[model samples]
Target: MELDDLDWKILALLQEDGRMTFTELAKRVSLSAPATTERVRRLEAAGVITGYSATVDPQRVGLPIESIVRVRVRSLDTPRFRTNVLVLPQILGADHVTGDDCWLLRVVCRSMVELEQLVEEAQRYGDTTTSLVFSSHVRNRPVDISIFVGIVSR
Candidate 1:
């Protein structure tokens, strides 16, 4: 879908606050509530707006420790390893990537013992290199849609 300036503005506002009502968004974008709602619905239908979700602080929710686990799996066990990782509650996100490690996982645990246990369970599938996160500088930032305004993709 080709996005205009108004659509970009609507996306920017929605990214900042997903819960914003259509009336409020319409006011900001200088459109009628019905028009804004239709535009948002079209964006969703086009898969530009995937889903809305709340951002929560993992530490505040009692899972304080965060670790990045780089996992190297045997070629034959890759599928089984991915299935195992999906069922592990401590894993927040998993990425299949290049380099030495086939998978990178974002994990959160309540304590060091829990982290150890999680890693031990993961070891059955692959060799893992885990690094504890001290602090995050930036995370979950809104995408800049301005760059794609007039770009044509082949």
Candidate 2:
């Protein structure tokens, strides 16, 4: 979609706080509440706004250990690995990337034993390398629109 300045502003504000009401959003964007609602709906219809979700701290949820598991799966086992990985609750997210590793997974576990077991399960497919996350400098920062300012038409 060709988003204008107002649309970008709405996106920025929504990304900051998805729960913001249309009335407040309209006030911020200098538009009527109905207009703000219409724009938001249009953005949603166009698939620009996918969905809203809550950010939960793993530690508070009894899952403190965070690890990045890099798996280099054998060519024949890729499909099976992908299907099985989703069933593992410890895996928070996975990315199929380019490089020596076929899959990069973000996992959280209650204890080291669980993490070890997870790694061992992955090793059944192929080589595995796991690293515990000490700290995350940027967990889930809002997208910086400035980088796409010139690239995307206003």
Candidate 3:
């Protein structure tokens, strides 16, 4: 699992563009295609590279509105609340955080009415405070693994 400079370089390139071909990745990292492929396989085997996925624009797909919902629930209801949230298609992501709110959810909908309906459904499990997003300054950004790698390798 020890990653050298080449491994880090490979990871950085892949993070920037997961769809990059092995030949192109090899060219950038100064390795043969087969060697690069082997390195990537090793990284995957070590669980360093979990999976590859395509990034889609929710707005372009007709789900334009996004909202952040902070949910407060009784301790006994946490598990059931999470299970409910998982099955809800509007919920893009949910996290249990330390605060007045037991959970925070990123939800996307086509309209305000849809957003209201989603919130009402969530209210069955817990109380929710919803905030509509006007614009996102920073969406999903690639993680800078160098910091963690340096700390771990030291």
Candidate 4:
């Protein structure tokens, strides 16, 4: 999908507010509602627009403890570790990455004891290092289209 300026604008607007109506988006972009709708549809079909979701505050919702858990899994236990983590509700997100630690997880728990239990479970796979989050500078910022200007053009 070759995204022209209009498509980029639509993406920016939608990222800022996914709930924005097509008509409203059209007005801002100086295009007809149906045209804007079609462009959005194209973006979705091309896999650029994956899905819309509500951002929830973990602290407000009773899960106040947020931590980053890094796990260095034994090569033999990688599959088992992946399988086990899927059922853990405390794990908000996980990324398999390149480093001394094979897995980085965003975890939220109701209390420190719960986090300790989670760490113990993870230790079954391999060594674990966990750090509680004090603050977040950027939570969920919108994607800046300007960053991709040259690359997208090429």
Q: Against the true structure, whose TM-score is highest? A: 4
Considering TM-score, which of the candidate structures 1 and 3 is the better prediction for this target?
1
Write the number of the candidate with greater lDDT, choosing between 1 and 2: 2
Best-performing candidate as measured by lDDT: 4
Between candidates 2 and 4, the one scoring higher on lDDT is 4
Q: Model 3 compared with the native: what TM-score? A: 0.89
TM-score list, all predictions? 0.92, 0.93, 0.89, 0.94
State, as a TM-score between 0 and 1, how close model 1 is to the true structure: 0.92
- Which residue pairs of candidate 4 clash? none
Candidate 1 lDDT, 1-154, residue by residue in tens:
8888888889989998999999999999899999999999999999999999998899999999999998898898888887876579889888889999988989999999999998887788889999999999988888876577463321
Once model 3 is optimally superposed onto the true structure by TM-score, how far is the C-alpha of residue 119 displaced, in angstroms?
Answer: 0.9
Candidate 3's C-alpha runs over 4 A off are: 145-154
* lDDT of every model, 2 decimals: 0.89, 0.90, 0.86, 0.91
Clashes of 1: 0
Angstrom error of the Cα, residue 49, model 3: value is 1.2
**Model 1 pairs in collision:** none
> Clashes in candidate 3: how many?
0
**Candidate 3 lDDT for residue 97:** 91
Worst lDDT window (10 residues) for model 2? 145-154
TM-score leaderboard ranking: 4, 2, 1, 3
Off by over 4 Å in 2: 150-154
